[model samples]
Target chain A: MAMSTASRVRRQLPTSPWLFAAPGLLIIGAFILYPFVSTLVNAFTDRRTLIPGRFVGLANFRELLQDDMFWVGLRNSTLYVVGVVPALVVLPLLLALLVQKNIPGITFFRSAFYTPVVASIVVVGLIWVWLLDERGLVNSLLETIGVGRVGFLSDQWLLLLSAMAVTVWKGLGYYMIIYLAALANVPRELHEAAAVDGAGAIRRFLTVTVPAVRSTMVLVGALSSVAAFKVFSEVYLMAGPSGGPAGEDTTLVMLVQRTGTGLTGRVGYASAISVVVFVVTVALMLLVLRADRRDES
Target chain B: MSVMEKVRPTASRPRTDAREPRVTDENGRRVRVGELVLRYLLLLAVLALTVGPFVWQLSTSLKGPTEDIFSSPPKFLPGDPTLHNYERVADTIPVWDYALNSLKVAAANVATNCVGSALAGYALARLRYRGRRAATLAFVLAMLVPVEGIIIAQFTTMRELGLNNTLIGVVLPGCVSALNVLLMRNAFLNLPYEIEEAAYVDGANVWQRFLRIAVPSVKGTLAVVAIFAFMGAWDDFLWPLIVLSDPSKFTLTIGLNYLHGTFANDERLVAAGTIIAVAPLIALFACLQRYFFRGVGEGAVKG
Candidate 1:
């Protein structure tokens, strides 16, 4: 059957296969692959938005070292990963366990919990912006409770922290679903055995469930860390386009947008920052995966 | 009760009372009433955390201008519910146009991803061709290259092609996403080869077999791709913000940002704008949640 199928599939016109793959290949090559290569090339050149630039080697990288905004951007982006990844990893697992049982109306609760995931980040960002506004629900509630109105969007560290919280909030449902799938695959016997051995819920979770989904937790760590590193829209929307007070809340991607756009936009410099982003994202992924591997060993 | 009977719900006699239906876990073990109550409390708390903000936004949007939105002890519900804010949002910006633009981009994204990925995926999976591995590799590599990193170059590419500020430019870069192509490839690869072999033997061409046989089998995956494409395009902020310079061409996300930026003073207007932007997606998600959850599971496992 294999031999016959292979022969039959080969009988089709040679051009037909290329035709089938043409549109996808063309678009991905043009927009994704080609631009990726150009980002590498353009990183070395002093290209502006309008002016085609000549290769200037590592001047952009050297400039990045001296650029204060670049450092601010790096600091904030790194802080974002630190602030967001752990909460994303642990909280969602708990949420998944909470929703895992097939209680009546459990499906509705699952979907409802996932509502934030479905909404656009812009909407989510804006919603939180208002909610965290000094005159908004959070502050209003706070003031009523005698804590007084705290400015969530004004202070630099607080702004970054708030953005991280929003990132975690929006992401909770997404990672919850991922953990739910992972939890479903955990053997009932392992859990039952643990319970029989006099393990409480927390003990069972640590011994049986944690070990079972440890790899998934690693996967979540890797995925969320990478995403958190590329953090833009949440901070962008919450902090406004200028990226909060004195641009202290600027993320790497935000810096890229701010620098790399407009007629006078420093395309080369932005690409250089982008290169840094790419390198760090790759490193974060490797770091998480290596940690998982080390644990296995 | 015997120990065995206490442990097993089935071994015990069924309850005669119909008023309170027995609640069982996935394993069909009856949960204790205390535990069930505790679970409900946790579920409701999480529900409020997750779904509460959107409700707050909706309520704010509905509140009339006369109502104090910023009153201490923030009003959860509008004292006088009205569509006045929605009207003001439209009056302030060409929000309907922006929404239309978003719809156009999202619809185009869905169509292109569905058609383009299906064809590419079918070819990669079903066709025995040279360089198929390289083509597949190209997509994998493309998928790995994050869009945030490539925006400057993509913007240049769009400018060079004179596509910047156009909806086409906004839609082009992601119209046939490599991830969707790979997803479709996996879907096609999972089908039994014998079915296609029969079609080939019956003289159905590759295209015919793909359309009539292969495509139908993977409608679930296709729907998944479509939903994600629409959501991705609609919810996208940075790419559209970068690609589109003209206010007329701004998608809903960019427009919301504009609205928020210009009208930050009025929470009511901004709230209305967000509601307009998010309501359709929430509705879409509500209607197709089963597929959405299935997609999430499949995508996560595959990832």
Candidate 2:
């Protein structure tokens, strides 16, 4: 039997790899690739809104250019991406180093930090709403300290800040876990060598730990940037579907969903918004990758 | 030199003994005490930041209906703790039905991901056949496009297939998570080819070799993938909200939103509903904490 098998193997019959790959590839084609192309195609054709309009060349794009809400969302999203990326990159590294040691109950701390990531956005939003309400815990605490009630989810700037805070809170542990893995891989000898050279704790961390995790820094930074662009649930659930008062906290995804599903129901226009979002995200990723390559070179 | 004391303890020993003088110098003993104090102070502050709100929610959820949730001074504990809020939530909505719907979607996702991603990942990693490079490229590109960006079109596609308003609609798009496939592919690539070769020499064909040999070798990656798929499905809201409109077909997340809408005036009931929605996920994460962290790190490092 073994000889027969060896003989058959010698012939090297061609078995189609596609047979194994077909299911996943089919799903991707049906769900992602096809939709992506359809979105691009739909951006030019007004199908769902107002008398099933025809292919209006550049009309949706033209309107998107003129729309004030689009610009508001774009500005808010840009601000969000700028504000959240640095915290995700830096704070998580600090937290990761803090818990990297095998101290007693360190695992509990890690899990505590990670619990928010597992919870639904609805839950996170609900909890924050209660905590940030005028008479809520935070405001009450501030009042006790002689400060006035701060509108975390009402005042425009505060609303944006509150949204950013939630993202940072939920994401810190996830990036920390990634950094922990990278920290584990950093050579222990480097720290020892730094110590032997009389480098202080801060200096050793600066020279040894920071440089070792640079690649992780870029990865986390880039992922966080994409997340900032794709942020919807937090804003949607927190600010209601309209994205808070006057759509102050509206994100790009929120714009897309609102346009596509609301009473107006402009599918083509929503596709345009999504295309713009996709382009912006891809551009951010490319910029990140370019910088990474430059560092490598 | 005292900083070197912070080096990871050697893995051979179970306990990292505090008395170990691995980094002790002339002034090490005195400095170590301060260092440990500062370290725990910082950890405690962070612990409070992350876990504080959840603890607050738990307290609020247990508070009686008439208890002042928004008192002048913040109340950290419930004045009169009761099961009234939970009972109220259960009375208001079909809580168990929503939980079952969420479980159904999550189970289908796990099943599809385990079978589909594993097979595709194996083929991608091990086989050198036609269109392999193209398929790999397609998967990578697919991963870059966030699902939110293409959701409208995806919804339409689901409608075209008559899957809208069904649990399958929510599960179909996520059946093959590109990250999960990449993880499994990396796992398969890390395995030695000698085993597969030996199986071939013993008359085992592709399917037999894959099922009997390759599959068993990457159980860790499979478990990680399964956990991620389950979590994604369970916590999903937007897709199910868009797909299923019927209250009977609503998942836990949608149900929670509906509960919030109905009980808008009652903060305690809303708090109770949020806890019910969040508890299972926290429990799952607690049980699978090892895999959850490992999976995040694995995806990050490899990608």
Candidate 3:
């Protein structure tokens, strides 16, 4: 009887939340938090394989400001983020709307659009290289139309565009599904009401549909921009290690990966590059968030 | 407003006619000629841009080196398509071996990540004890910390564990993915808790309650988690390249990199091997595209 009453008393107590949280906290702290801190410190040091020797302070940062390769990589990364994020946001929305209707063979259409998302970036890159080679199918098709062959994954001017193209292709399905879901969540009666108002479908889309999915567009745009910023696998794989032919396709991430983990053990310099990337990404995210909030207001 | 007022139909029928908006059909569609042409043109352009490379890959992979892919007019299709390049890429490297290695690593990673995530997710979801809010915060924060930042520390850890040159290193750091854990947590949170409590009262332990009640309820989440884990493990190049130095231990992703080293600028074999490497993913996603999207969208929403 005493034990039963004691159990009742125990039941009255609030649950301790720490028991469930500790495991996740411990692992993340070790792997993520610690490393991020170490990288910040590493930004102040010379390129050392094991440990830093002297305090370089802002020397690395100063050098980075003047580094031509750094500027090129940053410029490429920015241009890529600009070019690719728009396609990622827009193409998927278009695809999602086109196929969200209960057309015959909708599943086939969906899969055809989504299959690229599943394929490995490395494979996509390699495959595209052949396809865009001077004698590739695209050029041959163009030749059939009397357009001369142009290097798709090569040529300094087109290299990043090729990477952006593949990025948009491989990732469109993911955001398409997001769009599909948002589109589904839209109350169907809203469309009907608009139709009842004698409004055409185009007016309904602009007035009702677009605003309804504004949050999703904001989200997809932000995430896509971030992914573009870290455009590593495709850039490295499609474009050569030296950032395509003659450094035309280099991004900040590529520079960090190549210089940090390549033949040289410039972990510090690479970490510095990583630091710059982290700052830029965070800054972009903040800017987007601010603009979004402002728009919301 | 001005344009609408100008274009408002002033016919005998009232403007509020209940007639269906036939905007989609070729006849009912009143899209301006310019916009209609632009729409189809843009659609075709994106489609060509998207599918063009794959078509080229298919054609080039079949062509012989003598039939240059870089010819001025570019070969849309191989004159006499051959499996010679495929055979060459397969012969040049241990293609099957690398593929198997990729499968094994991906399998182990999927299994470990799924189990770890499910257990942790349940623990956080229904077993509210203390610090639950803090855990969620940490997970969100952890999500922002990119792979580039932690890769260095993870490398050190692998070296310390003497697993740097093994597949274990390639798979272990990713075993406890925060993203998957949070995904499962959200999924589990969406599940009704009373059923789990009923199991709890029936003398079932936490594991039994989880296995019996939670797993079946969120199998969609599990499958999606599995696909993500599998793809992440499969497509991961940098981690494997960093950890596994031996050629024999190369995963398909790393093996692709090996092609870069071996054939610096040789496009044909690399293209062939690339196609081979990613073929299964293409097939798998083709089979489960909807579920994968269900997972990705929910994954993004919760994330």
Candidate 4:
């Protein structure tokens, strides 16, 4: 078998491997790699939808320095990372511990929890939009409790907060599963040892469970922070395409989409914003990984 | 000890029947009744939070126009349940046609991802040739390139090809994702080399070995790739919104966005529209949850 296999391997056509990889290579090259290169190139050129632009050489970047909307976009996107990451990193861990057992109907509960993750962000956003509307269910419930409806969508800050909450709600199950996998690898003996040492549930969790799942927490933090920074659809759907009252809720990606499309889109400027997004995401990844390493020592 | 014995049947030593009221934790120890109740209460609360919005939407969709949906102490159940809003949504927009468009894009994405990734994965994993490392590097780099950052360039590329405002343009950029390619590669790598050696000895060509021997073994990963591709395409808003300009070619997500924008006042109509968009996906998830969980586990471990 070995001899025949060797001979057949030698006899295989050289072009066959290329043939197998061609379609994938072609599609990604044309769609992903090529576009990525062009995004970098266009960041320097004063490009638009209908016009091929000349090299502008940092003019777009210089304009980004003074753009108020760019500042708003930056502030909001950064705030999203801050507002959403810790909750995602922590809540999902608690949730994973809740359903980690082999209890009856746990599968149903797990699947149910994941329902939000399965639904499109558009649907999730719209549902929240209606739910938080002045005459919506949540407001009605609030009024019944004698608390008048507070404007969730109308207020710019509240709008950002609501979108963050929706993001966390949608993300809980996904990170829960990740934490569950991490939690399983945690040895039962450690919990037993902690119990025998008279550590209560909270003590055992803080000393035992948290440390055990710290790496997974970092992983969740990294993923969620990056995703939160790039948030567009939820804010777009909730706050409208113009991005809420005075466009205060506009995220960086929403800015990218807003500026980069249409007949008179400033592609060059949008590409510069996109470059900022890319840099920040890469920095976020490195920062998390660095934090993880620092914690190790 | 008594509690432990009650939860764990002594007769069945190894195989614990799921229906036999076994309530042991993962370590096979009895969870105290108080703790179990607390856990359950927390689970129910979360379930309400997670699944409640969807249920409320469904109820709102069923509410008749005469029923005050916004009544304080909001009605949990729709009085005189009706599907009138669903009909109204269709009249308001070409919802079914948009759904069909989404289905076409999603189906095409699934096909391209599965076939393209499998072929590329086989080459990267099994068939050794020149520039294999570079090819692998290409996919890895491609996977790292964030799609959100390149929308303008992609739109321009599509326009340069004169494919903008078309469904094909909507399907083209993400039809064969690099992430799925790497996923397939990892799956193929995990398979034992000796499984395909016998086929090689039998003079089976690479295609035959891949099709008959390799492909069958990696069906789980293929299913994962297919499901994710379908969901990604279906749930996608930004790309489809950017690529397709014609309202006639709008995917369900973009169509729903249009509906929400145009008729933000009528909550019932918007609620009904969301349900139509989400219910099929939820049903799909319900039926294939086993695969979904497994996929999540595998992805987390590998990622």
Candidate 5:
């Protein structure tokens, strides 16, 4: 029986890899790949709103390049990618390191920090809206501290800042977990060796600790960057229908939603934005993948 | 070196050599004091920003109906807290029905995503298959590309299948979470193959082997997938909003969203309903925090 099984495996390993992969492959093709290609192709056509319209040419792309809203959306997304991604990357690592201690009641603090990450984006946004309202606790706290009230959600600059703040807050627990898992993989023996060498704490961290978790850092950073691009519900909840004060908090995803479903209703126009978002995200990923792969080799 | 100096590292230098005596110098003594204060201050800032809102929300939920929520110096602590808002919220919507509906959809969704993830992940990790890597990467890439177009198409598909406004409608769309697939696959790949082979040698079937061996080994990953699946399904609003326009069939999420307009945006009622809707997730999360940690860290936006 064992011999027969061994022979069967030998035969199967060589020729059957593709055959076993069909069902899932088909779903991927139908749902993911096809939609992506169709979306890009549809971008070039003249689709009237949510209705089925005819194909036009590069006119959609031309309009996308010329439209001022598209530019604003692009610039805001860029700021978010720059602002939120790094904070998501850094703050979480710091928190994980802090909470990794075995101090009394530290577990409770860890649990509290992570609770927000599990909450829905809409819920978080709604809470943040109340928190940022003119007479909100944030302002009250500021007033108590003798700082005059400043609009956290209304001023355009502060709105983007608040959006990023919420983005960071929701993500802090998540990235901390990533950083925790990554930290777990660092062998205890290495730390002991660094300790034996009279290496100061900073020296040990820089030389041994940081290097061990480099892969995780790359992986976590890249994933968070992509997440920042897909950020939708937060903006929807905070900014209401238009993406936030003066559209400053609008992300690439919000723009796609607005163009696809709302008064704009231009399917081709929205498809063009989708294509652009798709490209931008792909570009961000390629950059990270290339850098990480290069580091690996 | 002084005893206090030997414990905490200076702020500018965060590294604490587990073995080496902590760094100390005559001129740097005052500098260390300032750095220590700054580090604690920054950590305090993080705590205040992150947990402060929940405290305020709790306070607001306790406020009376006519109490000014949008006030001059927004009352952090209501002068008089009451359960009147909670009572009204319970009256406004069938809270139990909404809760049950949410549980039903969320549980069914989690079960489907789990079984789907297990089968798909098993096939990807162990079964000899054609274009497996490419297929896996395709799913990963799909997640990266915008799904706005597909939502409309999903709506169209649901309409065509007569699945709209049904629990199955929500569960079907969630059946194949690609990120869950990647997580399970990565977990399975890391597991020792010898266990499965030993089961194979004993004439155990593939499904039995998976149940006995692979499943037990990847319990952590499964827990992670289950938690996120429940959270994602329970909190989903857009699909339910788009598919079911009827209030009777509404999920808890849609009902909470409805609370605002239903009560004419009465601040207290909305606050009460929002508090009710968000409370369980926060509670469930507190009970099962580790799974969420694993899921978030395991989130894959890569191909």
Candidate 6:
């Protein structure tokens, strides 16, 4: 047998590299790679439960096209992304601007804000459920101010708004910390120069600070949208797993879970729905990346 | 100490802008003072908004069952504070068992990620290999793939492996975080190549060089990875819920969710369970905040 090109490259490359990457690659292969490929194949079949079913090419996708729940989930997820991303991105930048300054008790404020982020989503949901309950503290405060009780969790529209508020509240400090790190890299002289040129604090922020942190703004935008799109646990805990009344709060992930694990047990159909979820989320990310590049150029 | 140093401004040096008294003294001082006051007020408002809910929950958890948690113009403080709800929570659920399960999953994740990711990252950064670019791109794409999208398949995988309902199954999928791999890779890339080359010249094999040289050099990044892995495993709810059917195998999050579902009427007890679940994570974050904040930027800035 002749020495082959593969053998030549194998000899050239250190085998220790493979030794090093083996454990990581093995686990990722078994878990992520295998599951991803299985999900892809599963989308084409009628597989459900532990029993493997026969292939039904594109049938799941076909049914999904006409599925009303799928469309509702798509709409709700989009609405969630639209409702939450702006505040999650913009408010953090403003908050970072406030806390980035070296002042007394700044760390205390930082920790206080970050406390929510540290808590699990379950805990966050529990606390928010209590806070926004019909006869809860918020309602009591509103009553004291002579306003009627708002059904934050009961009313569908208010439920959606409350979910967004909870997400924004939890995320504000996390993104603020990211922006704080970015703010440190922005040279101080730019602000001083702007000040020397008679620009006020707000003017300095608008002209100098915002522009410097624009990339982080893009980052925050992308991250928050991804998070918003994957809005399951919040809706699950706040609303029920049936995604509240009329399925108004159901995101695509919820739909996938409902189809796969719900009474239906249609794993293939759920896999098909997840394929859509993957496509749409990756598309959203690409759209942001492309827009960011366009802005840069 | 470094966090404190960063937060403290150098006020020891006296002002030297007296020559520009008209510009620096009059308008600047007034405007700065006004801005400072406004900033403090707005920041305090945000602080109250962020921490106020937790405070309310803590109070609610501490209150007696007959205190009327729903009282209008709700009391911020518990008048007759008690640990009755906490006792109820402990009585109701296997809180300690769930906590022990969570700790096992989190510790396993930290160990696996720190060791596996460091090895892979070192190889990718320092060792010559075929398909290195492909490997790196795979990790990046792996990160962008939504976990829920493949969750059904992941469940099937766990079942196939006979690891279902086991803590190992819960920890395996997340053992090597793509983010940490990238973080460690970045940390390794920033290291001076000369040291590794010298070790090689001194007859050190790749493993020896990696262990003695590269691993020691990236302790900070390792700490970051460890914390990230710990928090991720600690905070996970969905995967564990999917994998572990047995309540005995349940993590704290699942236990709390169980409490929420079963004890829907008992708000204070549920609140107590929530606190039990969250308090450790908050304490961990407090201890490792410097590394946590730095880790967030380390990944992002390099990207």
Among these predictions, the greatest TM-score belongs to 1
Q: How well is each residue in A1-297 modelled by candidate 5, as lDDT tens digits?
A: 768887877675554445434444554555456656767777888765446668788889899888888887888888888988878767787787666644435567777777777776666777877777777767876887889788886787788778888888888887787787777778766775787789997898788877887877787778878777767766666666576666766776677766665334566777788877778877887888898899878
Greater lDDT among 1 and 2 belongs to 1
lDDT pick, better of 2 and 4: 4
Local error of candidate 3 at A137, Å? 2.3
Task: State the RMSD for candidate 4.
Answer: 3.0
Point to the candidate with the largest lDDT.
Answer: 1
lDDT of 3 by residue, B1-303 (tens): 434433444441343345644233211223455655655565566566666667667776788878877765455788888889888887889888999999999999889878778777876787755566677777777788878654655665566568877988888777768888898888999998888777766667555677888889999889988988998899887778777879999999889888866785677788788778877887787777766877777778765
What is the per-residue lDDT of model 1 for residues B1-303, given as tens digits with 9 covering 90 to 100? Answer: 245434666554355234466888887777899999999999999999999999999999999989999898778999989999999999999999999999999999999999999999998888878999999999889888888999999999999999999999999999998889999999999999899888978889877899999999999999999999999999999999999889988898999999999888999999999999999999999899988888887777656
lDDT of 4: 0.91
What TM-scores does chain A show, candidate by candidate in order? 0.97, 0.92, 0.90, 0.97, 0.86, 0.92
lDDT of 6 by residue, B1-303 (tens): 444334433331134343333212211222355666787898899988999888888999999978989988788899999999988888999998999999999999999999999988987788778878888877776766688888888888888789988999999999997778878888999999999878866667778889999999999999999988888898888788788889989999989888888887788998888888888888888888888887777766644
Per-residue lDDT of candidate 4, residues A208-280 (tens digit): 9999988888888888888988999889998999999999999999999999999999999899999999999
| Pairwise TM-score winner, candidates 1 and 6 | 1
TM per prediction: 0.97, 0.92, 0.85, 0.96, 0.81, 0.92
lDDT for each residue of candidate 6 in A1-297, tens digit (9 for 90 to 100): 235634653685667787887787777778888889889999999988666867999999999889998998998889999999989878998998888665557788888888888888889998998888888899999998999798898878888888888989888888998998888889876776787789997899899998898888898888878878888888888887678788887889988887776323678888999898888888888888899999889
The total of clashing pairs for model 4 equals 0
lDDT value, residue A253 of candidate 1: 99
Each candidate's lDDT (Cα)? 0.92, 0.85, 0.75, 0.91, 0.72, 0.84
For candidate 6, what is the DockQ?
Answer: 0.51
Clashes in each model (backbone N, CA, C under 3 Å)?
Answer: 0, 0, 10, 0, 12, 0
Q: What is the DockQ of each candidate?
A: 0.76, 0.58, 0.33, 0.76, 0.25, 0.51
Model 3 CAPRI rating: acceptable
Which wins on TM-score, candidate 3 or candidate 6?
6
Using lDDT as the yardstick, the better of models 2 and 6 is 2
RMSD to the native, candidate 1?
2.2
